[model samples]
Target: MQKVEKVTDKLPELGARFTLIIFLITIIMNWADKNLFSPKLNAILEDFGFAANETTPLGIIAALFMITTGIGMVIFGVIADRGQRKWITIICSFVYSILTILTYFTPNGIAGYWYLFFMRLVGGFGLGAVVPAIFSMIGDYASPDKRASTFSKFTVATIIGQMGGLALSSGFSEWRVGYLTVGLFEFVMAVLMIFIKEPKKGVSEEELHSVLVAGAEYQFKFKKEDIKILWNNKSNKWIILNFIDTIPGSMVAFVLFKYLDDYYNIKESDVLILMGVGILGGIFGAILFGYIGDQLFKKNKNARAIIAFFCNLAPVFSYMLLFLPLFNDLYVPDGVTFGELISYPEVQFLTIIVFISLFINQGNGPNWYSSVLDVNLPEHRSTMISVASFADLLGNALGPLIGSLVYQFISGRAAMITVAIFWFANSLFWIPVIRNIKADIENNKKILELRSNQLKPPDN
Candidate 1:
């Protein structure tokens, strides 16, 4: 057996703060793409000469974008494992940014919908590529002990991006302006990313600290056979399969505002205010749970998954409070601003419920992200994340179409109830993960330690 050399120097911090800021902004822009058109769906439909009730076209467009995004995750994930992640991210960002700008030029009529559809389909690939690259870099930057908290910040960026997209698109008279604005921001980020340094693989692992500090590289690279190794990991199996949660999560995401409008006669402006409050809850939940997960991780390796299980279940009850006829008498008067809306006793009560539901629902992202990093090898992290994200993107792709069908055939209320049930079911998959996580983490550490011992230090 090989042995690690004595550490002669401290392992350098790899521009973690700067890198995180850039990646966080990238994540925000990528997620914003998902919601850019959603808030102004009616306006887009009207511009395209479609009937007010026609939503299938929009659903189809959303589904196509998700499908392409899934493909990009898998493709870019593989490439990121073997190539320079920095350049891959830059190129993908440029691709999506250009396509987003093109959306601003869409002509009015049914043709414009097709044009928008194509742009989304192609742009989604760019969006998909960024997920694996950013997460892979994050795994290297964040120490094992702090991964959940770090990951939580990125998850918060996702929520912020979602709200930002909604606000930007709806704030304007022309929905296309939102896409243009988002595209410009993405382009600037891609340019700035050129100067951010990529961290050495596995630098954050305690097992590799001595090796890296002694001026040796963690030289293991991803290989084709590693796919089997990844699939065979027990924790990876649960993580990949646990993507069912996203289906209902996406269902609610695509339709929640529309549901409010149809069921409660809530106006778009009022829904935005409520959604803003929900975002605040989500941000708070992510940060709080991220701290809780990190604290618990110190005590038990299984704590992250355990927290995730309960958090997933919490939303079911909260959604019940929001969607049920309990608030039938609550109404927002015309042109109510945020202050006036909150002043209403019933609206204030509804806001509390929204905040709570979103707060708990947001817990799953940070913990899940940390869980993926904890189980996979450094060389395999990008590919594994991509594979896992593909599963998630698939759910996102199907969610809108399925939600539309359910709402059309059954009723809006039935669709929401269905979302709650699926959300509950997402919690069950975590049991297997909680059971297997400890062993998997141990196995990963052992591999890293072995690799660390084999690394050759640079000659003086």
Candidate 2:
């Protein structure tokens, strides 16, 4: 048995922390810009002379944005694995910002919708690269044990962006200003991206592995053949599970505002407040569950899957509260408008439930992200995540359409509850992962050892 040298030089801890912060802020800007239209959906359609009932166009545009985002992630994921992540992220961020700002320049009337649609479609391609590259960078910075917790912290930025977008769109009487604001912020962030140092791949493995096997070298470059390695891995099941799970998750993003305004009879302004509160829940959920995953993972490498299994079950029970007769009574009364019922106890109670449901709904993020990192090699991580992100985005792209079809056959309330079934099914898929997670971790360790042994000694 050969002894390994424990190198003292690691990526500076403060540098890693700063990198995460920058990535967090960048994503916040990206998501905020992308979702700026959510609260102002009706306002946007009104500008184009379409009735508020004409929501299919909105769904189509959102789906188009998501479709491009998915495709972009796959394309960029390949580049990130093989090329310079810093330049990829910088160029993409700049492009996305420029395109978003040009939303102010889209044509008017019926043509405006198509113009904005293609604008978002093109802009989403840039936005899509931001996430895959950021995740890939974080994979380099974060140790395998801390991947979920670090990723969860990063997700808090997304929740904040969601809230900020809703607030910006609804707060501005005119929706166009929201676009201007997000674009300006993104431009500032793109400039900031220029300063971020690209982290070396496999730094986490060198720094965080409990034991370094002598002569084990990490693979630095990824190849097209490695795609098969990602696909054949049993842990890739999480990729399919992400697809199943995000279908319902997308409805929460694209349909939640409409659902509250149209079905619950809540005013758009008030709905923003409710969504804001739910975002608070999401922040707490990501942090708390993320920490729990890190702790549990110290003992069980499969802990991410275990945490996800329970996280999936949680929303089922929480979302059911929305359907209870007691909960319904808390919504608008028969004679009372939402404005009048704002102070009612029942209304207040339902808002609290929304908070709980959202909290539980977000718990899946940390575990899922962490699990993906745990199973894949550093060289394959970006491509692996991008592949999963592609599936996740495709599901999200279809969510609004799926939600609409389900509503046609049932009450909107029932349709909302039915979304939980997908969550339940997503959890079931994790069961098989638990059985093989240990072996996968061990295999990864052995592969690292073999690769290290193949390297020639350094020249004096």
Candidate 3:
């Protein structure tokens, strides 16, 4: 490979800050767009002339959206790894933005359903690339020491985006208007991204050689075999963990509303409030646990894995508690009518448990992202994340099916217990990760060292 500048100057502070803002915007929009149709599903069905009896198309649409996005993440991850990340961000964002704007044109009746489905499938291809590209950029900007903390800070956008999506579902009068609003926000972001500059890969490596190495950079190209690196050896364990952990996690995402409605006999509107209480924990977890990971990682290289292990573990016990009468009794007062609980006059202790569990569960995310970044070279980080994302999406897609299957075979409570078991098993998968983290990080540093030295000036 031809030698290029080894380390480009870091972006101006303002530019770097704006880049993060753009990333947050893109993520928030991505999440909001995904959620746009769900809350308005009934309205959409009615508009398209689908009878109440014909509901299978809804599942088909959702499945297609997820499956296509998951596939796109892997494909675009490779391209982002090899190309200018800013360009990837711009193009992907543009595609989705345009698609969203066009949603208004979807025809009515069966044709409209297929039209929207195809549009969403294409839009997912664009939305899927946003995460890997932006995250990889964050890795380049953030030093290894601050990586987890940075990820945690950025994670707040994810929560806001997720919750914001829910709000938009009900906030708008028409689903098309909701789509247009999200699309407009996305288009503005894509335009702003035009001003951002791409960072030099591996600008944050700590080794002294990285400073000394001049005029050389790691040249990467797409290869079928490169995908193997994402799963071979050490990376495979985390990939598997993402898939396994998300299986139950998806239950929380997909089944929680219905479960709460059924268990409490509360209105769907009331459950949203409880769900919001738990989501607040995600914000707490991302910041607090992310800080812990960064601080500990400064001393112990395995801190990320350690943090992830505990975060995953704590949720297991907290989730299990939900099955007990004691858990419900804490929230449901003596002779308290369901209407009183719905009013939320007192703090819902069950929501607190959910808050704690969610806090702990979401806490693992930043550490996991940072750990993966630490173990891979800058050139490979996006691909690694994308691969993990693909697994995560796959697991989430499967999660509903698994939950439904379990619900059919056993009681709903038992099905939830199964989710807890999945979480427990998620913790178990981290053991090997703890053991291998140091070696993997070292291996990445060694590769950087080799590239750094390879471009040294020849002796005079």
Candidate 4:
């Protein structure tokens, strides 16, 4: 392959910092857009003259949105691999923001339902495109050794965004205001993104650093044939297959609010507060596990997969504690403020369980992201992430649909027990990943070194 000459100067330290800030903000807004409507689903449905209990329409809408988002990720992941990622992300942000704001104008009745449904489906494209593009840039910007910690920041952002959206939409008297507000903020992020300069691919790789400093670019682009290369990689195969984890994870998440409401008689406001506490624990866990994964990764190439395996396994037990007869007697008293509710021994015990379960569960994100980046070539990173993310989307889409059926046929606890089994299965699947990661990393390094040699200028 002929070496491509570097076109722009290397990204400055200051510029890189700015870029990271913008990317984090954009991720937060994107996630908030996806989640804001969820907490207000009943309100939106009622506004369209549907019953509050009519979940079918909302379920279909959610499924379609995930389908569109997955399609967008595949399409834009290819573009992100071959084109300028910054512009792609900016355009996507703008597209989603506009659609989100337009949702405020939806009229009542069947017309309104169709409007909301189409808005979400079309809006998913923008939401999906940003992820692969941003992660691709992160792969280029973050040092290999510190990648888990860096990716953890994005994970934290996602949690905060989820919490923020739920809080805003549920707190507001009018749910449309939530969409309008988030849309305006996302638009501002798109404008701010205009200032970010795109980083050259593979700029952070140890093998290519010297060549990049000497003004050579890592110019590999994704081709249709490269799909075979992706499937051939052992680690990539495991990573993509890791979607099984998300299926039960999403099932548990989907029914959590309803379970609490039905079983514990907790109000929406109190549930939000409890969710906030759990999310805070999750944020702490991501940061802590991310740092730990990075340190362990310095010693063993398989450390991330190992950490992920245990993280997945540990959560199963905690979830059982929450769902099984262990917590059957607990109940939240009506009309108690959230602060007062936490003072109850039963509420406190349940809260602690939720916090711990979420804290451990969050460890999977950063390590999984770092492992994917480690096992792929720079040009292949976005496409690989898209494939993995689409698998995740599939699991998320199916989980709620399946969980709803299970909840109808059996008890809520039965549905949750199924979630635990799926989680255990997810943990077992990581064993193959642990076995394959070291060799994959070494193979990727060897390829980068060979490419770097070819890019080197001839000696005088």
| Most accurate candidate by lDDT | 1
Per-residue accuracy of model 4 over 112-171 as CA lDDT, tens digit each: 899888998999999889899999888877778889998999999988887887788778
**Candidate 3 lDDT score relative to the true structure:** 0.74
TM-score of predicted model 1?
Answer: 0.94
Query: What are the clashing pairs of model 4?
Result: none
* Per-residue accuracy of model 1 over 21-55 as CA lDDT, tens digit each: 88898889888878876677778889999875677
TM-score of each: 0.94, 0.90, 0.86, 0.94
Worst 10 residues of 4 by lDDT: 1-10
Instruction: Put the candidates in lDDT order, highest first.
Output: 1, 4, 2, 3
Ranking by TM-score: 1, 4, 2, 3
Candidate 3 lDDT tens digits, 1-460: 2332223465734577777788888888777765555455557779889763343466456656767788888888888888887888889889989998898788888888889988988888887888888889888777788888888977777777767776776576676887888899999999888888877667667652254344345565556776676556584566456567877866555445445544555544555667688889989999999999989987999999999999888888877767666546333444655468755633365777788898988888889889888888777778878888877777766665566556545645666877987888778888899888888887777777776655453354
CA lDDT of each prediction against the hidden true structure: 0.84, 0.75, 0.74, 0.82
Runs with alpha carbons beyond 4 Å of true place in candidate 3:
1-8, 12-14, 37-56, 104-108, 208-231, 326-347, 401-418, 456-460
**Candidate 4 stretches greater than 4 Å from native:** 1-9, 12-14, 324-326, 331-333, 409-411, 457-460
Worst 10 residues of 3 by lDDT: 1-10
- Candidate 3 lDDT for residue 389: 84
